[model samples]
Structures are given as structure tokens and as C-alpha cells.
Target: MNILITGGSGFLGARLARTLLAQGSLALAGAPAQPIQRVVLVDRVAPPADLAADARVQPLLGDLGEQLAAGALPLADVQAVFHLAAAVSGECEADFDLGMRSNLDATRQLLEGCRRAGHAPVFVFSSSVAVFGDSPEQRLPEVIEDTTLPTPQNSYGIQKFIGEQLVADYTRKGFVQGRNVRLMTVSVRPGRPNGAASSFLSGMLREPLAGERARCPVAPETAVALSSPGNTVRGIIRASTASSTEWGARTAVNLPALTTTVGEMAQALERVAGKEATALIDWEPDAQIAKIITSWPSRFQPKRAQALGLAADESFEAILRDYVRENPQAVKLAVKG
Candidate 1:
């Protein structure tokens, strides 16, 4: 089997690639596991050295939209596709054109490529919780259930929701076996922050533990829905591997979430790396960021995701500890003895 992962060099994309490489083969719909012959990673940047060194990894380095537009992506032979690349919330708000090109145009191109291939490959689209938002006309429920309608309040959210519809329509046409998974914010992400408004969720802990000061854009009481990287990868793979009967409806599956407030997260950081780490977080409110984050539903009843056998983090503290354990070098603060 040949696989394609867009945004293959990103944190989540790279992680998912490494996992697939480790497995060596994939079993789809109860069929025998098929050996992964090649994995084409499509991204503007290169992946980590270790992943690049893998014999199975074929790096397709460039802007995904450009490559797909130029007919450069070799999708004809691809048996599966994992679309994880997109302009994030902050970037979308800052530049609408870039968001349209990167998020909307690129997605349509990818689906078109799959349709032309005639293989009907298993396509997994990484959507976002941003798709659900509070609007003046329609207030969001306290707990977002599977049945709740998505009222995207921002460009990024609206774009993701549009992509979800595209995937669903493409699947209905038998162009691809599409599965859309609405991912919760992944907290405690390793490495430097990017354009995502939710980057602060990781930065608040990552920078602090790295012995540097960090900013908290939202108030302490602001709540969020989160998931760890491990849990997130699991959900992505399950979206593809699950049998057709088990996949249920074609609507997007809201990945499991661990809800917590900003204050509680700070407390968890204190418990993990002691008061020194917590002190490093500077609470500086930003109304723009607050409005965007607050609009997102912070609690969910992702019954579809649960039925797909996805699991959420036990607690925020556990998420923090997992980060500290997995990326020991990224943590400069000594764990309290």
C-alpha cells in the first residue's frame, strides 16, 4: 500500500507518519494488513532527520496547494490519504486570501486528485473544534453533542466546515472513502509556537517548563477542550482503519475532548514542575484571542468518536506529565524531588 500525508512535516503529520512507519503495514476494514510500500510526505518543510532517514518515507517538499495545482502530487497510486495541512485560526483571520488558498483551495484540489485516480482511496480530513462556535443568532450549547449543528464564527472555522462538507459530498459520490474528524486543541505540543490561536495552550506550559517566560492571552477562567498528541494520532488512524459499518454516518466525528479551564491548567503545571514553572506564565489578556477561543464550545459529547473507539485524556495533569515524559530535553525545569 502507498500512503500520502499532506502537511507531512508538521508536528501531528510527522507523528502520524512515524506511527505508520512503525506499524509497517495497515489493516483496513478487517482485511489482512497490507505492507506499506511507500509513504509520500507532502509539505513545504522537511520532516525530522530520523523520519526523513526512513527507507519508506518519500519526501514531497513544497506548498501542498502549489504542488497539487501543478499536478505534482502522485495520488493515482495512493491507497490512503491523510490531509492535516491548513492555515490555522489566527492566520486565517489575519489573511483571508492565504486561508482560502491554503485551506479551501488545497482541499478541493486534493479531493479532485483522488477522484481522478479512480481508486476511491481512504481519505482522512483533519478538521477542527473551531468549526463549532457561538454566534449572535445561534448560541452554542454548553455541551456540544453529535447532533448539534456547527455555526462557524470565523474564517478558519468556516473553511474547515466547508472542507468537511466537501469530503462528505465526495464520499457520497464514491470518489473517496472520506472520514472527517473534528480534532480538539492538542495541548502541550512540543517545539515553538506557530500561528494557531490555541498555540498559547502549549506555549503556556512548553515555554515555562523550558525555563522561559510565557504569555496567557485569555483569562484564567477561560475554558478549553483539549487532547494529547498520542490520543489525537490514535483517533486519526482509527478514522481510516475502522470498518465501514463501524464508521456510522458521514458527518464529521468530533474527537474526544478533555475540558479544563486556564486556571486549572496553570495549577496542573504547578503540580508537575512546581511553583517555579507556574510563575513563569504571565497572565496578559488579549481580547481578540479571547473572543475567538471563547466562541469555541469547550465541552462535547462526541458519541460518534467514542463509538469509533477513540479515548480522551484522563486529566490535564496527565497530559502535562505525558509531555514532560515524552520530550524530556524540551523541559529545562527540574521535576520537583
Candidate 2:
């Protein structure tokens, strides 16, 4: 199977590509006749050096929106499309035009390209929980089923919601097999910060454990829904591979996971990394970030995602432990809170 992953250079996209390559090789090697052949990485910037070394991997550098507009993407014979490209919340909120072009227009172009391909490729979109907007008057009824209509509050959320609709309409028209996964804020990301409003969620823990100071842009009590990077990737891949019959809704479904406050997360970090790392976090609230964070839902009961076989971390401590295990260097920085 030929696979294409847009935004393949970004943290989530890069991790997913790596996972696919590793898994695809094992799965293909076991098959006597049918073998996975190629994986394409498309992004404005080049992927990391390690990914480029894989023989089966092909990295394409260019503006996806422009490329799609000019009919430049080579979509023929491609079995699946993982559309992870987008302008993140902070970036989008900072620059409206960039958001529209990257998030909305690019998606439309991609769908059009899929339609023009003449084959129904499995197109999996990485959406976000931001589509929920501020807490509803009734507070989501403790369990948000698959049928809830998206009530987007921000420009980024609005764009993502639009992208989901486009994917659904394209699927409904039999042009593509679409699956959208509404991801929660992924934490313990290993890398420099991107412009996501929720970057602090990971940064507060990641940087401190790296023996560096990390800033908390919100108060300790500020709560948010979260998932580990590993689980988020699993959910994305599941959406791509699952049969349409199994995927009842063309609309996006939230990935089930734990919800915690900044204080709880700090406590988890303290438990795993020790007090020294926790002390590295400086409480300096940014009103802009606070408003955005406040508007997001802190708790979610993703019944459909659970029934669909998606899983998540049981607690913030588990997530922190996984991060430490994945990044052993953090152990040296562990100190008492």
C-alpha cells in the first residue's frame, strides 16, 4: 500500500510516519506475496534526518495548499491519505489568513484532488477537540456521543469543523473513504515548541524533565483534556485502517482519555521526575492563552471512540512514566518537588 502523510515534519505527523514505517515493514515482511512498498511524507519543511534515511520513505517539500491547487500531488495508486497538516491554534489565532489558507482552503483542494483521482482512497483527518467550543450551558451531559453537532468557538476550531464536513461530504458522495478523529491535547511531546496554545501542557513537564525551565501560561488549577502522544498516533492509524462499516459516522469522534488540571499534571511530573523538575515550572499566566484554555472542555466521555476500540492513558502519572521511559535522559533531572 502506498501511503501519504501531510505535515509529516510536525511532531504528531513525524511520529505517526515513523510508527507506520516500522509496523508496515514487519507486516509486509511476513506476507509472502503482498508487501507494503512506499510511504510519502509531504510538508512545507523537510522531515528529520532519521526519517529521510528509510528507503521506503519519500519526503516532498512544498506548500501543500499550492501544490493541491495546481494539481501537483501525485495521488494515483495511493491507498491512503493521512491529512495531518494545519495551522495550529496559536498560529491560526495570530494570523487569520494563514489559517484559512492552510486549514480550510488546503483541505478543500485535497478533497478535490481525491475526487479527481477516480479511486476511493482512505483519507484520515487529524481533527481536534477544539470543535466543542466553550462548555455548553448543559455541560455535555457527562458523555458526548457520536451525534453531537460541532459548536466551534475559535477560528481554528471553525476551520477544523469545516474540514470535517468536507471530508464527510466527500465520503458521502463516494469520492473517498473518510475518517476524522478529534484528538485531545497531546502531551509529553519530545521536541521544541510549536505555536499551539496547549504547548505549555507538554512544555511544563517536558522542559523541566530536560533540566530546563518551563513556563506555565495558565494557573495551576486550569484543567484540560489530554492524551499521550503514543495513544494519539494509535487513534489516527486506527481511523485510517478501520473498515467503513465499522466506522459508523463520517463526522469526527473524540478520542477517549483522562482529563486533568495543570496542578494535577505538575503533581504527576513531580512524582516521576521529582521536586526539582516541578520547581522549574514558573507560574506566569498569559491572558490570551488563558482565554483560549478556559474556553476548551476539560472533561469528555467519548463513548463512540471507546466502542470503536480506541484506548488512552488511565492517569497523568501513567503518561509521565511513559514519557520518562521513552526519554530516559529525563531520569537525571528528576528531583524532589
- Which candidate has the top score in TM-score? 1
User: Against the unseen true structure, what C-alpha lDDT does each candidate score?
Assistant: 0.93, 0.84
lDDT of 2: 0.84
Instruction: Tell me the tens digit of each residue's lDDT in model 1 across 201-232.
Output: 99999999999999999999999999999999
Angstrom error of the Cα, residue 128, model 2: value is 0.5
Q: List clash counts for every candidate, in order.
A: 0, 6
What are the models' TM-scores? 0.98, 0.93
Q: In model 2, where do residues sit more than 4 Å from their true spots? A: 25-34, 135-143, 329-332, 335-337
Model 1, global lDDT: 0.93
Task: Give residue 84's lDDT in candidate 1 (0 to 100).
Answer: 99
lDDT of 2 by residue, 132-189 (tens): 7665563544445567767777889999999999999999999998998899999988
Worst 10 residues of 1 by lDDT: 24-33
* Lowest lDDT 10-residue stretch of candidate 2: 25-34
